[model samples]
Target: MVTPFQVHVHLRRHLMKELPETDDAVAQWCRDQFVVKDGLLDKHALEDTFSDKELQEIRRPVKSLLVVTSWAILVSLGALKFLHWSALLSSWKGIALSAIGLAVVTVLMQILIRFSQSERSTPAKVAPAKPKNGGEPSETRQNKEQ
Candidate 1:
């Protein structure tokens, strides 16, 4: 989600610097790929961006996250049940514990997902090598020669 959203932001920034023709192209792409409606996304337009394989790749992590989150919730509930049965926590304490547990799980999940996505989002930048003769790059010189 973060990766795709970041790409969208980058594309928007790119569009701002481009010419009107380029702007039209970018706008068309955005219209086809994303559907924003009343400050929310339109599900059908969003689905149009990816093919079946890409959708499956996205679904894999989401499914995993759901499973992990469910497990975390269950564990938190189990802990609360234990605390209740043992009388180790008062009502306020139980509520506090549940809130803290939920917060921790949500934060950790976000951090882990963001970390994983970051690696894919940023590629190593390679500066073009300067020509030894120092006029223009060899490719440009070659084009002039022809």
Candidate 2:
């Protein structure tokens, strides 16, 4: 339920905390980035200060690690299969079972990646109920009266 603005502030604070050891000037700069004016976040100023370059820098190592880990896992599995053919391919024929396992894993990964993206902040719109007497919903009627 965390809002985007909350995320922005939290990230700013986290960076400010972490930046001091690397460079005091950068830490001070991050602290100055999220100054709120007139009770609203200065979003443009925030974006200007903490640009996408910083985000990309953070993501680069993690992505590289993931790619390397995925390759290592695949290689290990291949090695295991080569070492123990009977154990890996005992039941349900041979290639068919492997193909099915690969297909299932691929489909599940696709589903997981698709759903992991950020969701819409707005609530879903619901169709107003059909009035018993063919009129607006009672909530709307009450609001109009007020």
Candidate 3:
């Protein structure tokens, strides 16, 4: 059996060879696709499977949430149909109230984040110094006059 260290070395070379050439555009492309694998013996192991297709594959579940949530609501209401109206009122009341609370909290969070980001740096502090006029202060003037 191949040792893990040897396997890691093999993977690392494979990753480096597969990386785009060191031109700016290609490097940026690689940066988006490739992450530095720190744990392996050859730490910079880079493998394939980075692309728009990969991202879409990853995002499938998130994109399906709208469809899933709709179906969930339909199923729940179907089960609720045999129940009394009071059951419906009690079951969904908290969900509706929580949704409203979430909206209000989200708006407040956005306002707080915007204000925090917009805060400007305070003006730099100036060192205190004796005020000077057209002539140097007398204590210093005699030294200059000499």
Model 2, which residues run further than 4 Å from truth? 1-59, 62-67, 70-75, 82-92, 120-146
Cand. 3 Cα-lDDT? 0.60
Please write out the lDDT profile of model 1 over residues 1-146, one tens digit for every residue. Answer: 45543222111244555534564687786785455432233433465442233332224667888899999999989987887796646677876876797799999999998987845457779887555767687888888889
RMSD of each: 13.7, 15.3, 18.2
lDDT of each: 0.63, 0.65, 0.60
TM-score of each: 0.28, 0.31, 0.23
Error of 1 at 40 (Å): 36
User: Which candidate number has the best TM-score?
Assistant: 2
The 10-residue segment of model 2 with minimum total lDDT is: 6-15
Looking at model 3, residue 72 earns an lDDT score of 96
| lDDT, ranked from best to worst | 2, 1, 3
Most lDDT-accurate candidate = 2
Candidate 2, residue 34: Cα displacement in angstroms equals 18
- Model 3 Cα lDDT, one tens digit per residue, 1-146: 87564221223244667767856768786665454533332333354332223232224566589899999999889656734443534657856865686699899999999988966789999877545653577778777779
